[model samples]
Target: MWMKAVLVALLAFALGYLYHTNPMLQNQTLHLITQSIPQSLFSSQHEPNSANLEETISRAWDALITAPTRQWGRIAVGVNACIDVVVSGVNLLQALALDPGYGHDHDVLHSKEDLKETFIHYMERGAAAERFFSDKEVFQRIARAAAEFPGSQVYVGGNAALMGQKLASYPELEVLLCGPVGPKLHELLDDHIVVPPQSLQETDEFHLILEYKAGERWASSQAPQANRFILSHDVSNGEMSTLETFLDSLDEFQPRLVVLSGLHMMEGMGRALWENRIKEFAVAIADVRNEAPIHLELASMTDREYMSIITKEQVLPMVNSIGLNEQELLFLSQAGGGPHSDLHSWSGIPDVGRVSDILLWILEQHGQADPDSEAHLTRIHFHTLAYHVLVTVDGHWRNQRSTVAAGARVASSQACGLQAVDVSKVELKAPLSFYSSFTEPKESLVLDPSNPVTVWQRRNVSFHLSPVLICKQPLRTVGLGDAISAEGLVYSEIVSQLHLD
Candidate 1:
């Protein structure tokens, strides 16, 4: 009888151990990426997969910059910084029920508070993340590194508000690309800014990616048409792995200027993957640039320090090989202004003007490919000039309730199409909202169409819209500038709206 009891106890113990380590059950866990994702997720295989380069780049960017939103879209970063709640909830319950001995000695799972403490420790250990962000050193380093990109332009896209507040000297614009349907929440609510277009063209200049934000449907659908000579694409999380493979397969379509924006709003996990993939792709771009010439511009709303080390340390250095400074390579947080600046609220005319100037400066910078072209890219120049007028209008109509007329008048006057969409006539199978800022704002947005709210509305805001072009146009026509205003306004409005989709 004693021998039989011992044999039974040993068999049960073995069974419990096996059950805990079961591959099938572990595969279903939330941390599967860390445990089961292939080794290739961290590897950089440079063999050109020409057929899927665009998809590959898009996926890589999404994983690195937008993973939080894509993967953990339901969680808030500040209030619910720890991922332990959801991840550990079900696991703890199961452990208690199936294996009573699991937490007996640990005692960490005895009560709710104990379980919470255990979760914090376990999550940190499992994810291998630092307890707190080391912002001071990273920011100082970023500020210093930015100085290297003399005359470089900065563009901000993402959900972090601190980033915008940091870039006091540069220009910044926040763009929301994906809806907050995932486990992460990317919120930067502003009152009124237009969205950009979805179509991208493959041209000799570079590859441009324009992402949409949550809400602002009218603004998002109206972005500028893809340039005939350039390539563009909007990325997502599901496609990240494929994007990595595609980037590795670049044989013919080696883009000289690569622009990645609208990721600050993503969750930590997504951002981590995004940074890693971007670092890998940066090397690939560098390899191509070595054979030719390439310039890469990454627009971000997160603080320089918050971004993945791959981008802050690795990717930027790779781009600098041909000598583009960190500022030109990555959009510093300051460019987007401060935490007070929301994507929904109207930005001040000065802020708008500053961003336009920066855009022109960026577009005008002569890349390694165009060594002698001192003139700014004509299209980008026109866009910059037109954006100036849009900002002025935004400032002028900041306090107005019914902004359609103001938007239309500005669009008509500036020759840019800026119009509000009739929500009654719109189709929204997936009506979602997402936001990014230089500084993380309090409750970036509230998606209650019945109340129709923006971050600006909740925060109380105002802005000025002014349109101006600093650089000399190819044709020095005076009145032509005013005449072009209306068209520019319409174009800018449309482009802005495109981002809202």
Candidate 2:
């Protein structure tokens, strides 16, 4: 009896030892597996492999069955092992959901690093797929794949904020700009722009033209001639007659590019109408089979809250009516899905840059026939969008400015291997009523700095000149030159558009 008891105790000790060392015997769940096996599996030192995974796990299971203390350790070991299997399965499922094409890339299990990279690629694929789907579709797909990726949350508001910001910032690049009410926008001064209203009747050759409402500020700024452009302000504040007049003008002008600039200024003063203007315009254009492209540039009013509601509840719906595909539509967003950058306060920089490129592309396409025609000359348009924003509310402004400068300086240092950025080129467009631009208007968008997809493409045109002098409000007048010459860091938001494969 003594010999049998000793033998049983020895067996139990051996089994317990095996279970402790073996990963297979351990639980699959992160928490339970931690309890069942030693912490070495997760350690960076020990590389994970399929065979090792199997072998270690099997030993853990064997411990529960063969050990003398099997009864005591069995429950915990079994639970841990089960948890591990589930967790691994979950990881696999999540990856597969992200990319249906996964597993075809490789057959045999390799190093942990390889597995991690593959997993990340799949996750990215899944995210891209999700962007193409609607809310309902996303919800359905996510529900099916829920067990695969743990701790994932879906935004209920959808991509409204993302899309709105994109559209605001990027206007059509190939736009036939025609306007006089606003200042000769610095961005489009060189391209086929028609200034002042009188020149509109003279030129009927161009397909599209942007026009603005007439005002005292505009009349003083009128150019020599105006191309046959669409009228932006035929309406009397809220009068329906404005649409009638606009349609009539469109028929007469027969322009291909249309733009409505500074429309939000009217909205702020309670003179603006046509809440769903984009949708209505789409319907009207479709009825007439108008091949011209239309664009509306609106600045937000004082209350951002109201702007949000309008964009989500009204503007987005209108944009959809204009027939944008999934990818193209998303490009209009401020977020990744669209055009808005998290950097600025829904203030557009990137989107406008994109639009400038697109407009240049369109014009270039048209200009190919008569390459040297003055009509194809670069025209830059600058629209000033001013909102009632408290740029420096309270004392938080000073610290925020410092933080911004510090971040820029750091970025410059890393990118150029220099302590400070040199402002080699500083270009400024003529300042209009609300804003100004300084970019060269006639350039094409360059898709890539290196290995660009299109030879004809140039980066989006910047509205502001390079090497901007940023300073605090209090120091604006007195310390402006000192800051630029002494302390300020000059940088550029170099725009680069990607070509779809």
Candidate 3:
């Protein structure tokens, strides 16, 4: 028995050494890791029974043929910081007993106790971010390690040390987490932590994710057709001081690209408050624009009902680009009273022509309604499980060559990010099978030269679609959107810089 144990240990050490040193072996190991993850970990309890899934996949392939390519460069991302406690494979109906008529799917939880209880339940189930770091030194070490990616700097505002913890692994990346030093936040950060300019002195808040597996039968408590809910303790996030601090960080970081997220938590807080916050943010962004060009992108997992408030208060005068899923786009169309308001239902597969029309309508409405507004949306992106579609207005900051290439790169990075999360791997890179899956041709839809409905072209805007690498059995879907948005935005910035050089 002793001899056998020794032999096994020796073999394991050898294998580990080979995996570390050999690139091919490392790739094989990643593939094996991806394949070994259980479908139950992230698959939805309700599977699609309709035949439209194949149709959607086919349309996505047709869209991929038009993807353009470009050179890549280095970019920095400055984000309003918040922690995401991702709890996968949850049954929304069973866990929250949510009623479908409450509001809409993906609404924020208003009750603090209810939110706390949900967090506790998921923490017991081995969810990450359960415990705040007891020691500030340990937290700093972890954060420093995660920010190692070369030519990138991540400035996390507010007191989300846990969110910053993940970026510590990328040693070459520069990372800064700035916020007040309260007893709670102080405990999370070192006493010597340097607060960034204009940082608010307040406690941190958390974003709770009760993610259900894909293909699950669970119905949305508020919207029966919907299957997910993203609850956040973000009422404090809307305070004037917090917004000011976030703006200050923007000035200090001077990031080329900014991703505005977590605004849905401000629901029920009153329209005045929302308007004030947006005004402040817009003003700050305008100030920054005087020094350098900044690309502003808005990404949210908010409920459908909040689209109106967001469109009027935030998006109209500020955002240069918007990234959302198909459902969100449909909701935006309805909220904006566009031509596609009837598109309330999704049939698993997304229609490229319909989606293109919705985007065009959104752009046209923004142009007509806010004619006096200085900022115009240059790009509108809709990402679905099947593929990603990007519509670029002709005179936007990016040209066709750059936008198409950047979109394709973003799609590829998103596929790897999803696969990595599904398999519990932290690396952003995935195996070749992942890339191949995205570009593979399917026989469902063929492009015709004479077809009247040009799905990829409208009046002043041209659309670029790239099919995603499908994970037939996903293990987790909670952070996939954020992963895609963040990676894509960073990659786009990099490509833009390279083009400038």
TM-score of 3: 0.57
Name the candidate, 1 or 2, with the larger TM-score value. 1
Q: Model 2 residue 484 lDDT?
A: 20
Q: How well does model 3 score by local distance difference test?
A: 0.43
lDDT of 3 by residue, 343-431 (tens): 54555455555666677777776632234446556666666665566666665534333333344443433444441222222212212
Among all candidates shown, the one with the greatest lDDT: 3
- Candidate 2 on 187-279: residue-level lDDT in tens? 223333223242123211111111111110121232111111110111222122233344455545454333333233233223134355534
By summed lDDT, the worst window of 10 consecutive residues in model 2 runs over 74-83
Candidate 1 local lDDT, 211-287, one digit each (tens): 11111122112212111000112133212322333333333333222222223322223455656555555466555
TM-score versus the correct structure, for each prediction: 0.25, 0.24, 0.57
Q: What is the model-wide C-alpha lDDT for candidate 1?
A: 0.25
Question: Model 3: how far is 61 from its true place, Å?
Answer: 12
lDDT of model 2 at position 444? 20
Candidate 2 deviant stretches above 4 angstroms? 1-243, 271-290, 302-423, 426-501
- RMSD (Å) of each candidate, 1 decimal: 28.1, 30.3, 16.0
Model 3 worst lDDT run, 10 consecutive residues: 429-438
How far in Å is the alpha carbon of 423 misplaced in model 1?
25
